[model samples]
Target: MKNMVEIRWHGRGGQGAKTAALLFADSAMSSGKFIQAFPEYGPERMGAPVQSFDRLSDEPITLHCGITSPDIVVILDPTLMATVDTTAGVKDDGVIIINTALSPAQIRKEMGIKGKKIFTIDASGISKSTLGREIPNTPMLGALIKVSKLLDIEKVLDDTKKKLEKKFRTKPELIEGNLKAIKRAYEEVKGE
Candidate 1:
């Protein structure tokens, strides 16, 4: 696991955290990388806190357990910070990508996070404008890609488009909206 990168996702149920991890795994796999993605749920209800994990590496991954220390953490629901220890187990030099309207510095001050790199994006606003919904997962994925540099943006978008097409067959508009959301978040995320 020398080149391995582990990612932990924090979001609420019905917010597509699981879907985002799956999409990221699919994209990485398409790029010829070894990948694993899975979700851990609490009560399995809307607004319930949920966590998902992803491990990507150039070599095969043998670990089949929970990610205790992740290299990167993606927080789709900023509100979860109030109840969840979102930073728990993250490496000291880890990167944290948060979906919020606040700046990275503001988030760092509010959360009292130090040392680790922090990136922030208004994913909810991006999703609402691009997809006409408040689902922040897809936008968060874009922000993660931008911050992590894990995969090519074009490849992720192409792979994600194919997946979305399968799930939203006749809704070309929905597919395009999601793509737009990803691109917007990719370009709009701010880091410190």
Candidate 2:
């Protein structure tokens, strides 16, 4: 039982950023915690940038406002690094997970981030290598779970699998591959 934690996600549309947010919230709620998950949309197209949010708490959630200061930020698209302020409103102690090949030093320098934990993972690389595609949301979610240590990893996987099964009901092969992608990415993330 910890204090509330808020997470913001940055990605392009159709990248599963929203799905990742929902999956995290659903997993938290299933653990009997209060949770909120939603997305902020614009005129964004499939490849256009977007943002999603999640709030998890041990107590009942009464606030309906968007996250102003997230405890964790997950960047699902490396290209968003130049377009979006992914670090906006993050707390000093917050942790940021980015789907990039850059090291912490490079990320800190490039993103102009200071005084927070920066976790960099080549999620796209993991996804392409393991799942044979460019879909990176699940892999980035794996890295988030690893870096933030906010929820139970096994629970995250279980819940993600269950959710994906229903969402991809007509595509069992995708479901299986996504499950494996999550597992592999989760195991691959490196943290200090």
Candidate 3:
């Protein structure tokens, strides 16, 4: 697991956290990398806090337990920061991508975070304008990919398009909107 990258996602239920992890795993697998994507939650209801995890590596991943320490953290809802320790267990040099309009410096000050790289993006706004909804998961994926540099953006878009098509075939607009959201977030994310 020399090149392994663990990612933890924090978001509320019904906001596509699980879906984003799955899509990320699928995209990595499509690029010939080993990946594991799973969610950790119990009896959850809509708007309840939830967590999802992803492990990507160039070699086989044998561990089958929870991720206590992650190399990257993606926060799909800035509100979760009020209750969840969004930076919990992240490595000292880990990258954090948060869905918010605030600058990374502001988030760092508010959260009292240090050392780790922080990226902020208006994922909700991007999703609302592109997908007609406020689901920030897909846009967060873009931010993660941009920050992690673990996979090619084009390849991810292609793989994600294929996966999304299976379910949104009838609604081409929905599929396109999701793609647009991802690309927009990728470009608009700010880091500090």
Tens-digit lDDT track for model 1 on 54-128? 999999999998999999999999999989999998898999999999999999999898788899999999999
Error of 2 at 72 (Å): 0.7
User: Model 2 reaches what TM-score against the true structure?
Assistant: 0.91
lDDT of 3 at 99: 93
Q: Least lDDT summed over 10 consecutive residues: which range in candidate 1?
A: 40-49
Mark the regions of model 1 whose C-alpha exceeds 4 Å error after superposition: none
Please write out the lDDT profile of model 2 over residues 1-192, one tens digit for every residue. Answer: 368889999988899899889877887888788999999978978989899999989888888988889999898887787877888888998888888888877888877777988887888887887678888988887777777676788887788788878889998878777777777778877654
Better of 2 and 3 by TM-score: 3
Tens digits of lDDT, candidate 3, 138-165:
9999988899999999999988888889
Question: Could you tell me which residue pairs clash in candidate 2?
Answer: none
Task: At residue 124, give the lDDT of candidate 1.
Answer: 100
Q: TM-score of predicted model 1?
A: 0.97
Looking at model 1, residue 85 earns an lDDT score of 98
All candidates' lDDT scores? Answer: 0.93, 0.83, 0.92
